[model samples]
Target: MITVKAPGKLYIAGEYAVLEPGHPALVVALDRFITVSITETQDQGTINSRQYLETNFHWRRRGDQMIFDNRDNPYHYILEAIRVVEALALEMGHTLRVFDLDINSQLEDQGGRKYGLGSSAAVTVATVKALIEFYQLPLNRLDIFKLAAIAHFNVQGNGSLGDIAASVFGGWIAFSTFDKDWLRTVLKNNTFSEIIASDWPGLKIELLRVPSELELLIGWTGSPASTSHLVDRITIAKFAQKQQYQNFLESSRRCVETMIKGIKAAEVNVIKDGIRLNRQLIKQLGVFSQVDIETPELAELCQIAEDYGGAAKSSGAGGGDCGIVLTDHSVDQARLISAWNQHQITTLPLTVFELTGANV
Candidate 1:
């Protein structure tokens, strides 16, 4: 059997603004991961997972296309990964074979509740990694990232694709989005192979260095929010209030740039200040959009962390889900965790997933 793993991610700063091309966001890969394993099969192939209510999916091949026994399925990203990789394989004159794919995830609770840890993106990347390895394809991490991004874009159809980059290149990264319109034009004019090889305008991913004096903490508010739904709501508000939206974007850009500089220079104060400012900006955005980006639980999460001398804010789209905190080593982490526990907030024991030689 062939196995591959991709790590989950959390957004440190620049959430809604990063959707615009060239806007930057800071994201970090977590220790948690989604693992995909594959074994060759002669006839029908199966997919099994403990994460879903319907745990088994059977499929047969019709040429290069997969015909699943049940159309209503939860493997949209996984299936898309297989389709695109198979297309690439066939384009390279490689024959296809059947395989049983197994998925295991650590990005959720035992009840299968997601922690807003980028599970979909990790699974997609893991599936692409597994198939490329299974076929012995000559592709690097960047190639896998591009393939997974394409599949994810096809399904979600929005967002910065920063999570995909974090999963591909582990650890801290400053990510800038690509021009979605340009990508659409390229897809229309070129073949899949050519599209993969072409440059994506305005997209950039640079790894970051964390200061030794800094400590990161995560708190999950027992509620999960649909990122897509939140984004869609914010988009409607953006068009209605164009000037306010533009101002928000400009402010977010400056804040993220400041944070990046701090990380690069190992200046803990600058980084923490940037986080606090970003949190206020997001709260203002919620007010103007009339959408509660930061719920009551998330507000309490941030307030408690701040009381303990940490800079805290909602991560990602943040209707609910996880909130991140940045603090110096001198702060009382034990007290902060205790405070969170009293408020029914679960403190996740997640650390930064440093990129090693073994990670792709």
Candidate 2:
């Protein structure tokens, strides 16, 4: 039996601009993770697969013939990862036969929907790891990262590819400009290149489980915004010479650097100030508003958090998803819960994971 676990991630800075060539992004691997396990089937007659969030996949073996049971609209990203494994097995002249595969995922909630906190990337990483172990494939982290990128793009249509790299490498990462065509060519040649790591310091994150004890209150708006849509909008705005948009990107870069320092020093007040400033700057992009971050009900929750001397900002793709708050005063757990109830916003508690590289 082989089992693999991979971490999810959140973009700390340079969200929309990272898709462009020159801009870079800072992302962290979160505590939430996806796990996959694979084992050879003892029945020797059929292969069975069970996956959460979708129909079961089954296949029968008659002599050497393999018959697959199809799933309607199978999660495209997972299928893509399995395809990569199949290709590698074909190259090695080994046919994947009877097997039992199981997948389990734990993700944080953004509003009501599962706003992607790199869940696709985590699944891709876990799939690659499981395949490598089950098939005894001689592939490294870079190879797995590249394969996961292909799978992610197949599902997302267009993505930054930074999330896959962060998931595979773990910890914090700074990605330089990536040219997909160039990367594809390099992969064909079986050659790899080194990337420069920036000097941004790391932060000490404490994982908290008490939902009500959080000084910062997070809530979701009702609107669902697509990451790809936001990227396209930002790209068009950049082409049209929106100076304020350009300024927002530049300021965000600077803010990341400052935030890194604040985290290292454990200066909670400085971190709060940086988050507040960054939220105001992000609002300048015209993508979000105070109302968008919180509904009339959630607005009251924010007011309660603010009364406790905390600041709140949207998490993930924004629109109507999760919002993060920072506070300096003592947390009023009861009041916070009451406020969320009054606003009809479901609150999810999260703990930040310490940054670490992939386990070899």
Candidate 3:
């Protein structure tokens, strides 16, 4: 059996703007993870997940394509992961094998509600990693990231693949999106392996070092938001308000760049200022886009953190999910948590997950 774990991610800065190619964002991998385990089987393959139900999903292979017994199951990411990895394996002169796979996730609450910590990306990365290990593929970290990105983009079809980068790299990362239009053009003229090996235009991923005194705090709003849905709405707004969207992109870029500089220079104040500016920028974006990027609960979450001298903002797409707080070690964490609880917000005890001997 081969087992692999991929950590969930949170966007620290650069939210909607990161969708544009070459625009930077800060994303960190959290300790919460999705685990995938696979073992060879002689008969039909099975997949079980308590997160889904008590039943197990069985599958059959028809010439390297997986055909599930239940076609309507909620395994789009998992199934696509299997297909992409198998395609690469076949290209490497390896025969596909039947395997029983198991998935377990720590990215959710007791009630099985996702914390918006990028569970879908984590699961997809874990599945791809497990399959790569099972087949003994000679792929490096970048190769794995590319393959997982391909599988993830095929399903989600929108948003920056920064979560996939965070899952694959497993640390604080400065990321820029790849040009999807360029990718589409390349895919039309290249093999899967060739495309994986090719340079993706505008893509960038750099691991960052957090200052010793910096502390990250996460708070849940008890409401989940659909990132794709929010992004779609923003896209429509972008088309209608071209100049406004362009201004947003420039401002977000500057804010994220400053934050990245602060991370590199170990300047907490600079980072905090960037976070504050980012909050306002996102508010302006919401006003123009006419989408509630930050809800009342999210505002409360950020306000409490700021009252405690911590810099805060909504983490992801942020109709209502988690908000992140960055502060020095001197802040009163207990008081902050108490304030959040009084407002019905749940503080998530999550820490950054760093890769062992990461190259970047």
Candidate 4:
């Protein structure tokens, strides 16, 4: 059996700003992961997930293509991932043999409530790794990330692919947007074989040192975020509001830069200031974009964390998902959690996941 596991990610800084080119987003890989297992099979290639009951899917080879019964499978990431790597194999003049695949995720509940921890990206990354192992492809971490991005980008049209990078190469890192326009053009214009063989010229992923004396406190808002819809709305708003949104993005860029430096240097005040400023800037984005970036509960949660002498902010796109608190000590961590509980926000069972291998 070929087994591969990839971690989920949380954005530490640089949210909406990373949508632009040449901007940095700091992301952390969490302990939770989407794991994929594959073994040689003779009859048919089947895909099953322990995380979703409705995701028992199977596929077969039809000439050179993989054919399936259901066209709109819920486990699209795995299917798309399989297709992507299959394209790579086909480009190399080989037919990928059949294998039975099983997927298991720690990122969501069985009832299908996403925790907003980049589950899709993790699934894509894990699937890519599993297929690579199955086929013995000579692909490195960056190759896996880029190929996984193809699968993810095929499914969701827009994203920085920062989450995918984090999952493929676990741990914290400073990431910039891959050339979305370039990738989109290739994905749209090129054949699957050409797309698989094409190089992603503008991809950027850099490693960052994790901060010291800080505890990562994560809390779930008890609701999921529609990141795709929110991203589409923001993209529309960026065009409509041009200069104003550009200013907001610039400010966000500065705040994220500060947070990265502070986290690296163990500068507590700089970290706190960056976190506080990010909250204000995200609110400004909400106003400029006319979208609810932060909910009342999240605002209250950040306030409670601030009151406890820690810094807090929403982790990702921020509609109704998890928020993070960077507290100085155990006392502050406990206080922030207790206070957030009072505000009806429950603390999530997550922490900063350290890498076992190379991060960069």
lDDT of 2 by residue, 1-360 (tens): 888888877665556556655555556566677787888876562223233444334577989998753321235666788877667666767778666667777753422234446666787788878887888877776667766776666556556777776677666566533665554554466412221111111211222122223244445444444555555555666666567667777887677556666656676666666666666665666543222322343345456656656765555445555556665446565676667666676665544454345454
Residue 119 of candidate 3: its Cα lDDT? 81
lDDT of 1 at 334: 95
Cα lDDT tens digits, model 3, 1-360, are 887899999999999999999789999999998999999999799988898563234577999999864322337889999999999899999999999999999877888777899987888899999999999999998999999888888877788999999999988999999999987787678777998889899999999998989989999999977787799899999999999999999999988998898889999999989989999999999999999999999999999999999999999899999999998976899999999999999999999999996422
Candidate 3 achieves a global lDDT of 0.89
- CA lDDT of each prediction against the hidden true structure: 0.90, 0.58, 0.89, 0.80
Error of 3 at 29 (Å): 0.2
Q: Worst 10-residue stretch by lDDT in candidate 4? A: 68-77
**Alpha-carbon runs more than 4 Å astray in model 3:** 54-74, 357-360
lDDT score for residue 189 of model 1: 82
Higher-TM-score candidate among 1 and 2? Answer: 1
Per residue, candidate 4 scores C-alpha lDDT tens digits across 1-360 of: 878788999987888888777778888899998888999999787888756674434477999998863422437778899999988877767767999989888987566777889988888898989988888877777778878988887887787889998897777788888678888788768876565556666567887776577677888887777776688889999999999898988888888888888878988778877888887888888888999989877777777877888788887888988888777764457666787878788787887677665532
Clashing pairs in 1: none
Cα deviation in Å at residue 38, candidate 4?
A: 0.8
Q: Which stretches of candidate 2 lie over 4 Å from their true place?
A: 21-26, 41-74, 85-100, 108-112, 138-143, 169-177, 184-225, 287-304, 327-334, 355-360
Ranking by TM-score: 1, 3, 4, 2
Q: Is 3 or 4 the stronger prediction by TM-score?
A: 3
Give candidate 3's error at residue 322 in angstroms. Answer: 0.1
User: Backbone clashes per model, in order?
Assistant: 0, 1, 0, 0
lDDT of 2 at 63: 92
RMSD of each: 5.2, 8.5, 5.3, 5.7
